[model samples]
Target chain A: MTISTTPVPEPVVADRPPEPVRRPARHARLREWWLGAALVLPALALAVAFKLVPLGRGVATSLESSSGFDGTSFAGADNYVRMFDDPVVRSSFRNALLVVATLPVWVVLPLVLAVLIHQQAPGWKFFRAVYFIPYTVAPIVVGIMFRQILAPDGPINALLRRVGLEPLAIEWLNGRYSALFSLVAVALWSFFGLGVMTYLAGLATIPGETLEAAYLDGAGFWRRLFHVVVPMLRPTVAYWSVLCASGVLIWLFPLIYALTQGGPGDATMLPEYLVFLTTFQFLDRGYGSAIGIALFVFVAVLSIFSVRHMFTEGTRKPR
Target chain B: MNRRTAARLGRYLLTFALVVVAVAAVYPLLFTVVSSLKTQAGFAEDPLGLPAGITLDNYLEAFRRMDMPRLLLNSLITTVGGLVLSVLAALLVAYAVTKLRFRGGKLVFLLIIVTLTIPSQAIIYPLYQTVLDLGMSGEYQGLILAYAAFGLPLGTYQLAGYFQQVPDELIEAARVDGAGHFTILFRLLAPIATPALAALAIFNFVWMWNDLLLPLVIMGGSDSKTLMVGVSLLSGQYDVSVPLVSAGLIVALLPVLVIYLVFQRQLVSGALAGSGK
Candidate 1:
């Protein structure tokens, strides 16, 4: 399958007739196979030892009960059952759902910005460069910075007070809904730059004549955006949507850790964060593994489309 | 309004909104840098105000309290080590799968790409146990290996795509000259693959440096904490000075900020490569 996909060099095919050199070619091919295996062995070993092996063990660990310094014993599905009744686990998944529900905003906001920038909006270059600055800062740093900024007596509230919005100057990270909202907003802020970059790459694949035709036909910006640009960007949009959806579950650990630590009354608890707390902090390896496995399953279901898309996309011949 | 005038107004509003978002994006970091230089008392009196008197006390204190040098060293070692290992693995695997075209190359490529969907969180605990079982817990190699393992998928995916573009004739020519795969890969293809490798390196560097989870979990209360872990711990401390924490945040952010400024193009392109179809 792999050999058929890649075109053999034309000169080799042209210069060397098939039957005459078949014997030496077979020898060379065997050598090539060995060389490929040798090159790939170390990486394959690392992946298996670290990733594949642990993945299976992680599932196994999830099914067992262990506590304190005691050795493990099989608990069957007790941990999974307990997860359903655990308020923290329940809310963590609930918050994860809430964050995932914000996927449209995550996808569309950067996309719109990318479109505007793609149109060469005034200062687009500067906007392109400056907008990515937040993404460069580590999420933990972003979280820590915002923790102070969102403190009740912090700059955000102070500015609100200065602007005569005293009532609106409430605790940003201390309230239930507000903390979750703040997290979503902050995560979006830190990530939208990459979204924009992705969309721009997608946009670059689009030919100019199509947009030019739309312009010449008197389509306005919004019309051109929705009509001409967006349809062409479905793959990119799907890509980002899948990325953000999974990201909301997996990638927000640092932000949650630094900003709210699953926050004011479990408002910001995510399953991934809860897994960390449960496994590392609370020492409930069985339950934490359960949550981890559950999160992994959810992410896998969500990622199937994108994974397939990316697989074909990655292997597709470069244009 | 006339269509032309309305279009002009829309353009103005669009630019204005873009500027506003740009400021929103950059303002927090500027706020942190400025506030880091302010006296604590000054910060308390007016948290939003520009500093009354610039002071380096917070930075100095942060450096001392956070053991800045040690954290920096730990972060440098892991980031560089992870970057080198992952990029090399990706480069070699990409070359093998793309150029070598041996049997099962497709399966090897597929296995690596599929791992992209597996989030580190899912495997965190077991991965931790594996590291501990190997007796590499709290060691540099443990975290480095984990980073390299996670990083391999994306790097290989991107580099394989890049490698596919290199015509087969190049490798064939080298082979005819009596070059083996290793020599051709390192001496020949590696240079050709430099742009892709550099972009992958920058991308992985930023991620591995900024990452807190692997280091935090694997290092596990060890003194050899990465800078992000150190900053996180600093924030977690009770009665922590906001300014001091701000300084620590800046300290953690400085390397990434410098990398961003210097390799802005590569960084942006790397991001593009990450998501590019």
Candidate 2:
């Protein structure tokens, strides 16, 4: 290889370089700042004004119990103390834990369902769409539909009558043991699509060659899925599980409101519903705000942990 | 048998199972529509079957009792207003995060991500008070703002992904051509991002349209209530009219059903693909 260079002489213009230096005009700088500010301002304003400010107010509100409009009187941390002491509140807490335990079934079933549909077996797209279609419908609509279907003259009763298993068709959402299960069923129906979608994306990243290699090594389907596919999809599983858990807690609003209305003797009164009752129904803004703060802190902590896990795992695998 | 042949057979079976599932999914809708057309006597006689004698009385009763037209209009205004605000604000934030280099860009993005963790219920009470304090309670603007707050994070995340896919060279060329940031965003990026924008719009449209809580609180007055609220109120203890409620639900759900059928693929793709992150 040969390299050649020409020596340059700077005798012509000793004061400056030959190329002109073009500084960004004032308008461009102004525009850059304006654009940047414009982009950051709306979201910032929304977050602070809507989220942060309200959160602060909620904390302050929790200290006061107003009997009339704008007649709040501070009671220190009595609301928090009351929250711990109240039997209904204690039961609500216990009920929430029970619901949380069932969260795993909703989380894992969706992942398993997603994997079932993501497989290259056949008609996967059709199955995927079929499962996902329910997610598009509003929770209100599902609530209304289930209300009818679980009613005495609904299809389930008719089906059971025909099968001579009439006792099996009982009041679903109105019964104590069955109401929570019904709500869970609805949640699974609505959100399993999201899980399926998430898992499909994870499956997309697993190269076909990897699966083929496993098959060639005489590994069976369940063995490959448990050993290879599950390991590769850990990040996705973690992300979805966290997301689904938080979503179950937050998005249970519509389902609870529509189906049970926290009914069958308050068997399904979630924290969100309780917050509503406290604030509006009972006119206890302070206590409602306290519950709101608690719910926010709970969701925030879970999400932070999950997102942290995602990043750590994601970094290790270069995802 | 060959693997291909076996796969083909499996596909057939899977498709058949899907058909059955789809039918099951749509059955409630069919029942609603059918029962709406039936007379009260006919419905009571055969609640699970087709009505022997059909009538539009349920629709008329539902419309008259629920004030369907006004409720529909209220829903439309709130959804449109909420969608416009959410999409614009989200796009602006998304554009900034994806394109501009700034010190707090990542922080702003992280803030949006964290906002998703803050459920609307968490802030409902304070938000209600804030709305009252602003003197905008029971107003469309308050409802729209609430919906926008809920929808902003998802919209920004989705739009950011869409914006990131546009080639850097295209943006660079536009910059060199003396196009300002606004011009590039409105003229160049807007057209390219239309499909994604449409998908987001549809998602927000359904969300805001079908939402029962914010409007239930902010717009609880008779003149201001949304479809969800109206339908819910109609189903209250005094007048537990199943047929009337079903009719109202169908009316409330028709627009969403139409949008879903028309853009099912895009909505599913955007939702699934976005969550893949």
Candidate 3:
């Protein structure tokens, strides 16, 4: 409907490579149309049934109230009001903020490493593969592995003891305040490869001649980086930052379920965790849907800037 | 020091840091493998050391306790079936949008791009409700459909990218020959886009395999647990045995690691292609 409907001859449109088979067979054309519809129907049906239906219902379900004893009824904004008033939900949102505040490490750590790899640092090839391996491993597997390693008497603590830094080895995953930090650290460890890959993918697009030109102009490494690479990677950075920003509500679900389980007084209880716990554990479908919607809104609003940048990235003219 | 020497020093320093990070990345999985071979008492005594003795006891115990074969079969069905469904569905839709004369194709693609931004968490409860209503709570058909649906947007988006690369003339020639769209797609275009299909195959397979949430909800407590759910359940049920837990994690990680190791180049190439690299 936007502009595709015009059918004004597109510059990119291919010429008719086939001589028109003028059989005058309207039935064949009808069959072709039917075939297209048939081919598209399965995917469309599943997409509609699972994705579109759930998304449309999420908000409506959020507005309804029900209890185990009492049946369901219409309750406008009651779920939202209850979410705001609850301490655990408040703490979940606050912790989500804390995670968001640590975006620098999430964004920059992989970027710096990728730059080095892109620069062909020694062992960069092996390191690139090594880093991406973490991304391949399931988050649940990572959580289970880290859970034991971060256990009170696990290798981390034992290593600290070996170095005579026993006092530094506090309860890692079990500590209420420390749990969220440790969880973030683990997540960063698990996911930085994705950022590296994304940045490296962006880095691939900048022509070598541009860098050569900069070098001939005596642009130093940092100078070339700031002036050339970062600007070019702006879209890539935006894409990843949005991903990391909104990642709080989605990617951490399995990790929290496996390792922390929102333990020791809800320090690591993310909004997504709240959704799962409320919906499944407490059986509060209405509140869970409401929290899910709120989180969705937060992520949607936060990513608007990045999504714009990404769309522009597709349309951007190479300078 | 001269700039040359400084650069060399910087390279060495960066190499050291890179090694440290790489080791941190690989160590946990390495530790899991090593620990899986250790005695419980040995692990208790020296958790970080090379094992005092090697044994398959933990693996055996974990396999028995976690029901490895059944979990893997269940996971394999979901992954293979899901990937097959996703690829076929995506291939068909991408072909239609890119090649076939279809109204609303542009809007459909746009809807998918917009839908990409809407996280699945927002819709999961209602999705569960729909699934339950259909009486497909723990059925493979339901799980496959869910995985296929969730993986579709990305799958179709990627497939469209590859589909567009096939010169329109080739498809039009086939169309003019009175060849069916199915024949044109599978016979003419698919052979050429094998790399894309394979990449999407591995990509969707790994995703469906590693996915914990969908399986967690749909396949819960129905004698049909996937590997991830099984491993998680193992840890919860057998909290005391660290070695056994490590074994369970290793078993869960093995196939994914193998796929990654074998198909690394394809994965990287696919990522680059998909990301506009």
Off by over 4 Å in 2: A1-31, A67-70, A120-125, A205-221, A305-319, B1-24, B165-169, B237-239, B272-277
Model 2 per-residue lDDT tens digits across residues A1-319: 1111222221132243333325568776666666677777877787777777787888898888764467888899988888888766666666677778887787666665566566554666666766666766777777886787777778878889899998888888878879888887877777676677778767766777875575445465558767877788887887787887677667778888778888777788788888888888888788888877888888888788664542233222112
TM per model?
Answer: 0.93, 0.87, 0.90
Q: Write the per-residue lDDT of candidate 1 for residues A1-319, one digit (tens) a residue.
A: 1222222233233354233312347777898798899878877877887888888998899899997679999999999999889999889989999998999899889988998887789989899988878888899999989988888888788889989999999888889899999999999999999899888878776777875576446666677777877888888888889989988998899999988899898999999899999998899898888899999899988887776875676577656
* Highest DockQ against the true fold, candidate: 1
Order of candidate numbers by TM-score, starting with the best: 1, 3, 2
Report lDDT (Cα) of residue A120, candidate 2: 50
DockQ of each: 0.50, 0.32, 0.47
| Candidate 3 regions with alpha-carbon error over 4 angstroms | A1-33, A212-223, A302-319, B177-179
A212-287: candidate 3 lDDT, tens digit per residue: 5654455666687678777878888877888899886688988898888988789899988888888888888888
**Once superposed on the true structure, which residue ranges of model 1 sit more than 4 Å away at CA?**
A1-24, A215-217, B269-277
Candidate 1: tens digits of C-alpha lDDT, residues B188-256: 666656666777777788899999899988997797779888888877783357788888889899898
User: Which scores higher on DockQ, 1 or 3?
Assistant: 1
Query: Model 3, range B51-105, lDDT digits (tens) per residue?
Result: 9789999999988877799999999988999889878888888887777666666
> iRMS values in order, in angstroms?
5.6, 10.4, 7.1
Clashing pairs in 2: none
Candidate 3's docking class is acceptable
